[model samples]
Target: MNCQTLLIDDAPAVRLQGAAGDTVTVLLRGAQVISWVDASGVERLYCSPASPLKGPQAVRGGVPVIFPQFAARGSLMRHGWARMRGWTLQPWDTSAPEPSVSLQLHNAVGDDPQWPHACVCTLTVSLLPNGLRMALTVENTGPASFSFHAALHTYLAVGDVAQTTLAGVLPEGAVLSLREPIDQIFEAVTGPLQLHSPLGLLRLEHAGFGDVVVWNPGPDAGLADLPPLGHTAFACVEAAAVMQPVALAPGAHWQGSQTLLSGL
Candidate 1:
């Protein structure tokens, strides 16, 4: 395994390469996994070419880290401050078998005053032989207890979103295919899902999360960051905990993870 720091559009980023030839690149801006290529040279994560590489806004694609809030559920911004804040990279043992890296986020004085709660959030990305795994851990460091929602908003690259089918999380034998606008939240989802695309079969599994959000704005959503018809090349399948906000006492911690395996 190998790890290195490099620039992506002049922004700092870390790239980890596995012994098996798979690689994952994470940006320090959002601790976001912006790229994941399998050993066979298949790019599994979708990143918008029009999205700003460095800014207060979150990138349009990749696996974005959403914390302290989800979407417009609270007054703290669309997806909270985690994805917009810069993260500090944590040291890791290079001797470890898996090629993994971790970035840490903590609230500071005079940060977003809307939801002022001291906290520490960590995002770890590990590359597998055929895919990758992402884990998020949040710890309350303030004097008061706080409640929040979090998710790993993962956008998967596909040959054609209209030809993709997702199974296992929905009703038995009821696969989901996207052709139009889709925004559905499934509660208490504890099973793994299978995404069949024109490229191959991608397996998705989640841990420590109860909700799975499937979303797509369709071809005409007119998202500024996405190119024309960009929605048809990817799909969003997020592992989340949003139905009920997690209440953490001072010094308490919570963890959740999402794993994607290709050709499984």
Candidate 2:
């Protein structure tokens, strides 16, 4: 069957009326979300960009485009360039049983100065029977040093912050926030990373990632224009990067995936 867009609104105030081709239904009540549904197939975060307690917008969300250097790229903004520009979209492949869509973004020649490199990035938002999956694939179409980040800065809906205890491969001080930096790291994590939110139990699991960043903008951190992020109803539990940057030689490819599951 040819691909078509469908809008279905179920009970309990679930807004599933968004166009399937335009945006993916990642969030139900704005809070239970998989925001940053860009046409480029990248999903940013709905909560704070950078770690709030760490620094607002430091590296918050919007499919941060990383380049030659991560923290010291000195190119466009933090991370590198990617998310800063508009992306193009087209149908690719969704082999999974559940409905899914794919989008791609490439640097144009006229506007290549920003990145000064030739590369193609594709983000796929696959709606699986169980949950949603976002996959990022970066390919070097030019002859240049290339390495960027494709992360999902997740703001997990929670009840309380202080009472939350996280499990998983996180070290004692792997890092909860940038300001309150810690030097702990866990080798292998199997159970759910627990968070004691006033709301209820919050659990986070890292599937294909090496680092995890947990954040709570707390009362001390100022506010922004993010209405989806209820004052303190969310917690930023992310799959961190900062490892070996993908040094693509030409015609090279790099890919990564991050998944989020939610429940009270």
Candidate 3:
């Protein structure tokens, strides 16, 4: 059965129930978190919401939604034009044994004049027995070559953000920004990520990524968008992105993935 039926006429931000009794919802304005359920007992992944190229604001948490190219310096926006454009549910696969689904967002019409790359992108969310899996695949449909970074931007829910730590990161020479001014970016985190606050301990591993960004927006930091968490409910251990730009060939295909494990 097509899972689209479960989401057929529902508003992008409204919640709906699946045929198998599962649940799904959309955040209209944010078009993020396309699908969600409570099978394993709690919400696992927050899909969509592109992560910014660098950042001015970069949304606090809950998948900022990514697109065309990540971290591309331009007048248009931080991350290309994908997250800013409205995506349609093209080919959804909710029948998989793992209860998976895929949504297609293409920029053939060159939605944003600034980002003139014709491309077809797919966002997939697959549910596993233990947790959830999210993957992004981009295929260049244009003649010109281009490249960008893609990140899941997961904000794992924790009992407390100040109490957690991140493992599996470069220990030295890692670049990071401070909570208050954030006026300038610094390089540090020379090794793995480890969080030892009041919350808990967390670990993140990156294969294709170069640096791990461990961000915990404290009360002192001014944030525009904050996820649904207690005062400091979530912590971000994002897979490091390309500090340098990636070059893509015409018709080139690129993919990025990140996984979050709890109870560590």
Candidate 4:
């Protein structure tokens, strides 16, 4: 079957199976992608073994969609409420011949008291033979203009932390190598980027998104959601609009996308 529904931690989840044996699993709890693998059964994304299964909190790994805010940079709670709430699974479009699914989040109006803006968000995930595509659209439904930041926090598994390299050079004219734990937001960049790691090479293409956040809580840092030495297993290269948020006028929507290709 190309599409299948199942339960994860008593939460609704969908599995989108692509033609070339690629498979992607997403949870309705946060409309977060928890697992992704290529046709050869080689896992592409990282889902922390210590990530909480059920949550009013963010999962430690995978593609966690951050919306309306990027961390504590706004009035909203850390990373906003998108990853902490469950999303509605939408019906598949018959016209699209590919294996795909859409998720919606619109209850932020009354539920969020900190910010008083009505909005609707739609996230579409499409599985491909060699990679995966994700699209996000956020519309302002309120009368006033609203501004917000967003990100696709992706945790990629690697063979070793010290050995991995972010293929693109920094805006300052130098490439970045993870020598210690890294946690920094990069300047806006254009075009595609490559990630060279021990496990494999990954190509990340950004569209309508400019900022990137490269993070890994080095060995010195400790997080409750991760296991001992878990930081060594994965590195996050996220697509985000953290440096500058998008401002939307009433009835207007902001859309962006990111593509991940495995073993390139």
lDDT of each: 0.89, 0.46, 0.50, 0.84
In lDDT terms, which candidate is top?
1
Clash tally, candidates in order: 0, 18, 34, 1
* Model 1 quality (TM-score): 0.97
Model 4 ranges off by over 4 Å:
none
lDDT of 2 by residue, 1-264 (tens): 124432323211111212333244322111123343333333424444333312223324323333333444355556455544344445534454545555567764456566577878775555432234566677888866665544445555444344444555445634242223122323334435655444444345545445555555555445554434343455565554555345677888877565544333
lDDT of 4 by residue, 150-173 (tens): 999999888687989886638554
Which of 1 and 2 is ahead in TM-score?
Answer: 1
Question: Stretches of candidate 1 above 4 Å error?
Answer: none
lDDT of 4: 0.84
Quote the lDDT for 38 in model 3: 43
> All candidates' TM-scores?
0.97, 0.62, 0.69, 0.95
RMSD of each: 1.2, 8.4, 6.3, 1.5
Best by TM-score, which number? 1
Q: lDDT ranking from best to worst?
A: 1, 4, 3, 2
lDDT tens readout by residue for model 3, 1-264: 324433323334434344445554444333355444544344533321342322233334455455544454446566655555555664544456665556667776356676677777776555444344566677888899876655555555555554444433433433232222212111333344444444333334334445454555566554434433323665555553446545578878776655433335
Model 1 agreement with the true structure over 58-126: per-residue lDDT tens digits:
899999998888999989879988888789999986765678899999895457788878989999899
Candidate 4 vs. true structure, TM-score: 0.95
Which of the two candidates, 2 or 3, achieves a greater TM-score against the reference? 3
Which ranking of candidates, highest TM-score first?
1, 4, 3, 2
Q: Tell me how many residue pairs clash in candidate 3.
A: 34
